[model samples]
Target chain A: MTQPLPMPVTLLGYGAATLTTLSFFPQAIKTVRSGDTRGISLRMYLLFTLGITAWGIYGLLTGDGPLIVANALTLVPALVVLERKVQSLRRGDDRLW
Target chain B: MTQPLPMPVTLLGYGAATLTTLSFFPQAIKTVRSGDTRGISLRMYLLFTLGITAWGIYGLLTGDGPLIVANALTLVPALVVLERKVQSLRRGDDRLW
Candidate 1:
């Protein structure tokens, strides 16, 4: 069995992992559904995508299973969001639709 | 100097920390500038806030300096976003402006 992280730590890890990873869902859905990227900042996505990559590295270095898993999973959706945002920008249509 | 994380790991950590930490800037600026929360998600914020709190705890538990610091810093802005989102919901102005 994976040794339980210290109780407090476990709570923190789970919470942190859950929030950071899932926070993008609404934006992702809305972006896709409405095809609107106006509200999203390409700069922010660029930064976020890069940051998540770093976190993934931290996870690997520390062999922190949670960090690795969380970051890895998040990278995909976050990247999608970033890519779409970029596409939206390049298209430069005021109305994303 | 902190022992360099494995070169690759260092790259990952720095990148992750930077991206995750800074990603919110665009939203924060846009949200404030436009006073629009139509695109923001309350549920996502609530979850994100709670998750960040958890990450904070994990940082403390593991004595991981980066995690602790990063999460702590991110929490304030994230909460602000959430609060604004909540307020926006309450106002239900149909026009955030």
Candidate 2:
């Protein structure tokens, strides 16, 4: 059996999770609302989404509750932002390079 | 003493770490090279930088090598992007909303 994380450590992890996950909302909202993506990097979002997916899988593999929940929650808005970014690029609204 | 993570688990963690961390480089390079911040969200970068900082501290506290290394490396490019975003906002090159 694995030992439980200390209270402080667990709290900190959750805090970190909340901050990082919530941070995506503003971008997602802005992108969805404005449909602007001039400054968003396609490669960044592409790699980020893939990485977060990996992280989600890693969390699942390890049975990490915070990691799992955080990544899953993060994926939603991240995907939204990424989708908008991709759409903008496809429309030639934004340049890829 | 803590038990070592399974080989696959450790590898997955590093893979996740690598992807997420490297993901920032494109944005950073794009921002620095082009000086464009039209679509970048001020709030997103502000909060994201803070969140990544917290994650780095969390990694240190937990003595997680992958976490520590990943976050530390990620911070550099994250900071660059954030700084450019902030500068753009300050210069009225970008809007807060």
Candidate 3:
């Protein structure tokens, strides 16, 4: 039989997932604070947002709680950044980057 | 006892992971082909690279083969794009974006 994962390993996974997921926080904060996304790449964010959505769905289907939690939290800030980026581009404030 | 994940669920997870991970390929291919990263944000890539590294470590520690495989493949192209970005910035070819 396959062995259960050790508690330490599980903890490490949780920690790593949490850290990597939360790493987007600073970027989100910056976007919110500056209201400028001139430096952000619209295509990258668009693709990433879609990718995250797919992963979230996959997680739900697979019953992978870690993936679901990570992607759900990640989507919030990513969407926020994406919305601001679109707004910035529309405003013709591209020079702020 | 907890049941083993269904084969379909596992397949979905693998497929989703592969697609999302491979989604970075076009950007990497573009950067490599054009040797232009002017439109790319250095800070974003830097943070992303670090985040991927952390995830890789987590995957290794947790024995999550999916994470390891995805991130390993991902890091290769990410690093290449990052190198090109730095080079383009240094060469003052910032207008290519």
Best by lDDT: 2
lDDT of 2 by residue, B1-97 (tens): 2677799987987788788889989989988998988778778887888888888888888787777788788889888988898888888888877
> If you assessed candidate 3 against the hidden native complex, which CAPRI class would it receive?
acceptable
**Residues forming the 10-long window of minimal summed lDDT in candidate 1 chain B:** B88-97
The predicted structure with the larger DockQ, 2 or 3, is 2
On DockQ, the stronger of 1 and 2 is: 2
For each candidate in the order shown, give its overall lDDT on alpha carbons: 0.72, 0.85, 0.72
Q: Give candidate 3's TM-score.
A: 0.68
Candidate 1 displacement at residue B21 in angstroms: 1.0
- Residue pairs that clash (backbone atoms under 3 angstroms), model 1: A12-B54, A15-B51, A47-B19, A51-B15, A51-B16, A51-B19, A54-B12, A54-B16, A55-B16
lDDT of 3 by residue, A9-84 (tens): 7676676667657756666776777674654656656777887888898888777787898999988988988888
Candidate 3, residue B40: the lDDT equals: 61
TM-scores, all models, native as reference: 0.78, 0.91, 0.68
Interface RMSD of each: 2.3, 1.3, 3.9
In model 2, which runs have C-alpha deviations exceeding 4 angstroms? Answer: A1-6, B1-6
How does model 2 score by TM-score?
Answer: 0.91
